[model samples]
Target: MSCCSTSLAAARSFGSVCSPPLTSSLTQMSSMLDTAAEQMMVHKDFQAALDTCDRGLESLANMEQEDSRCGEVKAGFCILGIQALAELNQWHGVLSWVLQQYEHQEKIPAKIMQMCILLYSKVGEPAVMQEAARVWLHCPSNSRVTGFRTVAELYLLHVLVPLGHRDEALELIVGEVGGSAFTEDQRQAALDVVEEKEQQKQEPPLNPSPNSETTAHTSSTQGAVVRKLEAMLRFFYRKLLLTGSGSFSLRKVFTAAVLLYMLFLRLDPAHPSSFMWISKLLQLLKQMWSAMFAPYHQALTHSKGL
Candidate 1:
C-alpha cells in the first residue's frame, strides 16, 4: 500500500479507539502547542514559536510510550516545527532534521512535503537544490502534491539553469508534463524566457566573420521576441486552467489539443480529433502571439536588411 494510504488507515484507527492517558496528553499537546506556535509567529515572536515547537516535540516524546498515536503526532509536530524554522531562515539544522524525521517515520503528514520543499527553497544553495530536484524526480509520481510540483519546478529552474543544463531542465519538464499536458497558454508564457536563453547561448562566432556582433545581437533580438510570445501564451493557459469549466466538450479539448500540435510542431500530437478544435484556439493564440511578436519582428526586419 502507498505510504499515504497506510497513514490514512492509522489515522482512522486512532480516531475510532478510545484514548488512554498518554494519548489524551499527546492530543492535547498537538492542539495547544500547534496553535500557540501559530499565534506566536503571527505576533512576530519567532523565538517563542520555536520554543513552542520544541516543547511540543518534548511532550510527544513523553507520551509516545503510552499512546499508540504518539508516532503520528510526533511526525505532525516535526513538520510544523520545520516550517516554522524555515520561516525564520534557520537553514543550518532544518534540512537535516526534516530528512531524518521523514526517513524514520512510516509516513509524514499529508502536506509535510510542502514544508520540505519550502525549506529547501529558502536555503537556495545549488547543491541542496540539486538534491531536492533529484528527490522530486525520483519520488513516486504520486508523491508529488500540488505545492510540491511548484517547488520541484522552481528547484530545477534555479539549479539547472545556472549549471548550463537547460537541456536537462527542458527534458525534465517535457517528461513530467509534455506539450499536450501543458495548455497552449502555458507554453506561450514560458516561450520567451526559454527562447531568449537559448538564443543568447547560440550567439556566435560559429561563422565568426565581420558583423559577428551584429549577427549575434540580431539572433538575441529574435529570440527575445519568441520568448515574449511564449510568456503571453502561458498567461492564457493559466487563465484557462484556472477558470475554464470542467465540462468543456470533448470537441473543445480535442480541437485545442490539435491546434496546439500545429502551433508547436515539435510537441507530440494527441488525439487526431483534436485538430477540429484548432480554428477557435488559433484565433485566440494568434492574437496573443501576434501582439507579443509584431513589434520585435518589425525591428528585427529593419535591422537585418531582410
Candidate 2:
C-alpha cells in the first residue's frame, strides 16, 4: 500500500479508540478519557492527549448537573491530564491547571491531591504542595473520603518532613486531621518516624560518602601519570641524544607508539580535568617527534638538493 494510505489507516484505527460512538452508558461517559489515555500510552502523544482531556472536561462542565458520575468522569480526565502534563515536562503548570478545574484548593479530590503531592515531592519542591494539601486536609467535607488517610500519610512523609515543618507535623498528628485520619497506634508510629527524621537531620554524618574522596584519588592518580610521563620523556630524549643517525634504531618508533597509546586510549576515564593531561602529553610528544626524526628530515632535504 502507499504510505499515505497506510498513515490514513493508522489514523482511522486511533479514531476508533479515541472517538467511540456516544452512548448513555457509564462506560461511554469516559470514552473521551479513554481516548486521551490511548494517546498518552499507545501513541506517546502527550500534548494531543492533554488537549483531549481539556475537551472532555469542557464537555463535563457544560452538563446540567454535577452528579457522582460526572464527578468520576471529571476526576478521570483531571488525573489523565496531570499525567499528560507531567509527561510533557510541564510540571510547574500542574497546580495552576488543577486550581482552574476545581476553583478552590480544598475542593480538589483526595486522589488528585495525592497525585499533586507526589509530583511536587518527586521534583524536590514538596513545599509547593504544602499549603494546598494543608487546606485540603483541613476541609471538613474531605475528612471522610476513602483516600483521606493516604493523602495524610503523603502530606506527612513527602511534604511535612521534607520541608522541616516538625511543629506543624506534630500538630497535625495530635490535632484534628491526624486524629480523624489515623488510628491511635498509627499516630504513634507516625510520631516515631517524624522524630527519627528530625534526629537524623540534627546529627552529623559519621562518615562521608565515597564520592567525597574522588578529588584526592584523582589528584594522586594524575600526579603518578605526570611523573611517569616526565620519566619517559627524559629517558627517550637522552637515548636520542646518545645515538647519532648511524646508530639509530626502532626505539624511537616504539616510544612514539607508547606515547600515542597513552595520549589516545584509556587516558580520561571520566576525570573532569583529563584534557590537561592530553594538552601536556601532546606538547611532550611533539618535542620527542622533532628530536627523534630531525636527522631523517635533514638527510632527505640534503639528498634532494644533491
Candidate 3:
C-alpha cells in the first residue's frame, strides 16, 4: 500500500477507537508530524525537522482545550524544536521559541517550565533564567507537583547561584530543602551547610572573656541558636515524611532520618513527648526500610531456591 493510503487507514482506525473526530484528527496530525520530524533528523536535516515541529505546534495552537495527550504532543514538538535549534547552534532561536510559546501563558505546565529553564541555562541566558525562576517560584507552592518542584529548586540553585543571586538561593534552601522540593544533591548541600554550622558551634571560641556577665550572655546566645537549629531539624524531619520521595532518593531519605534522630537526641534531652515521637519515627522507618528492601529479598530467596 502507498504510504498516504496506509496513514489514512491508520487514522480511520484511531478515530474508531478514540471517540470524537477532533481528538483523532489532532492525534493523527501529531503522529504524522512526529514521524516526519524523526525522518528529517535521521537525514541530518535539522531545519526540516524544525519546520515539522513548527507545524505540529501550529496545529496544537488551533486546538480549543489542552487535553493531556494534546499537551504531551505539544511538549514533544517543543523539545524537538529546541533540539533542532541546538544542533544549528541557534541559542537565541531556542530562547525566542520558549518566550513565544510559554512566557506569557496563563498556566504553564511544570514540565514545560522545567524544560525552558534548562534550555535557557544551556544557552547561558541569565536574564531568561531569572524570569523563569520568578515565574516558577511564584507558582502556588501547595499546588506544585513534588517532582517538578524538586527540579525547579535544583535549576534555580545551579543557575542562580553563579549569577550572584545568593540570597535567593539561600531562601530556596531554607524553604524547600527539608521538604520534597529538593534533589539529592540539593539535600546534600543543605545538610552540608547545617553540619558546618553545627561543627562551628561545637568548636570553642578563640578568645575567652573572663567576665561572668560576658560568659552568661554568650551561653544564652548559644542556647538560643541551638534551640532554633533543633526546631529546623524537627521541621525537616516532619516535612520529609509528609512529602515522600520528591527526588526518589532512598539514600537521602535514610540519611535524613538518621540525622534527625541524632539531632533529637542531642537537642531535646528531657521533653516528655520525645520518647513517643521517637517510637513513632522508628516504626515508620522500619516500615519504609522493609518496603524498600522487600523486592530484593524476594529475588534473593527465589535465586537461592533455584
Q: How many collisions per candidate?
A: 13, 0, 0
Write model 3 residue lDDT over 78-196, tens digit each, in one string.
66666667667775666568667665532555555565566666566756656655656656653365346655564555576546555565566666533547656866776565455
Rank candidates by lDDT, best first.
2, 3, 1
Give a tens-digit lDDT track for model 1, residues 1-306. 013223333333433344554445765865755464454445656556567767767666555364446655665556555655655667667656665555632134434544454455445655554664455545565344444455445545556654556766676556654332344565455544566677788888565588878988977874675455455555655554455334256336644754665577442236543343344456666664565467778899999995
Give the per-residue Cα lDDT of candidate 3 at 234. 53
Better of 2 and 3 by lDDT: 2
Clashing pairs in 3: none
Global lDDT scores for all candidate models: 0.54, 0.78, 0.59
lDDT per residue (tens digit) for residues 90-132 in model 2: 9899999999889999989887898889889998889999899
> What is the TM-score ranking, best to worst?
2, 3, 1
Q: Pick the candidate with the highest lDDT.
A: 2
What TM-score would every model get versus the actual structure?
Answer: 0.44, 0.65, 0.49
Clashing pairs in 2: none
User: Distance from true position, residue 205, model 2, in Å?
Assistant: 2.1
For residue 51, give model 2's deviation from the true position in Å: 0.8
* RMSD versus native structure for model 2: 11.5
